[model samples]
Target: MQDYLELFFNLIKQPIIQAVLCVIGSILAAKIADWIIGRVLSNLANRTSSTIDDNIIQILHRPIYYSILFIGLGISVKAFSLPEVLSFVLLGLFKTIAVIIWSFALFQSFMHFITWYGRQGKKDNVF
Candidate 1:
């Protein structure tokens, strides 16, 4: 029994297993986040008159989901005792993905706000 328990512990400590676990955990987290955003946040956004909130919510949904995924992936990659160059490259790739996703989301939100502002101005005859 003791030997079996030791072997199990050793297997669990393997880098590949740890990485897979991290990915699975991240995926589950992303799903939960998506569910909350789709059901609860969307309902709240719909209750409001302005569509700006809705747009913001829409812009945020995917980036937030991907961010969680990337975070998990980064952690998983770091769990492996990778060589310095490979580790650096992988971490950099994950960071780049995060930056791109967030920047795109912000750009989209900005565009939506500008459109809404323009509509308001037109309605008020300010422009």
Candidate 2:
């Protein structure tokens, strides 16, 4: 039993196994996040009159999901102990992707708010 346990630990310590576990954990986390965003927060947003909450939820959903995925991928790659140059390249790529995802979400949310404000302005005869 002790030998079997030691063997199991050794097998799990392999880089590939670590990477796979990281990826799986990240995916499961992303799914749970998505479900909460899609169901719970969305329901709460529906109860409110302001569109801000709704816009925020919408804008954040995909970025948050993909960010989790990227983080997982990054961890998985790091586990492989790749060449320094390759590791840095992957890190840079993930950073760029995260920035793009966040920027796009911000832009989308800003546009949504602007549109909502415009409608409000029209309703108030301010424009």
Candidate 3:
């Protein structure tokens, strides 16, 4: 048993293995985030009087997932010990993608809120 445990530990010490584990961990984290937003947060949002909160939560789910995924990927890339320039570029790319995704989500959520507010105003004859 000790021999097997030692072998497993040795294998896990490899950079490639570590990188793969990081990627897998990131995916799992993203999925957990999705589940939380979909199941737990959705339930909370549903209890609210306004649907805007629900829509905002739904919009945020993907951005949050992809942000976590990109961060992990960036770490994995660094684990490979590539040239500094290459690592910098790859990390920058991941950071850019995360920013873009979050920006898009924020824009979408804001638009949804604006539209909902407009509808409410119309219903109240405040328009």
lDDT of 2 by residue, 23-80 (tens): 9989999999999999999999999988888988988999999999889889988997
- Candidate 1 regions with alpha-carbon error over 4 angstroms: 1-8
Most accurate candidate by TM-score: 3
TM-score of 3: 0.91
**lDDT, candidate 3, residue 95?**
88
Candidate numbers sorted by lDDT from highest down:
1, 2, 3
Each prediction's Cα RMSD?
1.9, 1.6, 1.4
Look at candidate 2 and give me any clashing residue pairs. Answer: none
1-127 in candidate 1: lDDT tens per residue? 9999999899889999898899999999999999999889999999999999999999999999999998999899888768889989998998998899999999999999999999999999999
lDDT of 3: 0.91
C-alpha RMSD of candidate 3:
1.4
lDDT string for model 3 (28-122, tens) is 98899889989999999999999999999989999998998998898888777778999999999888888899999999998999999999999
Model 2 scores what on Cα lDDT?
Answer: 0.92
lDDT of 1: 0.94
lDDT of each: 0.94, 0.92, 0.91
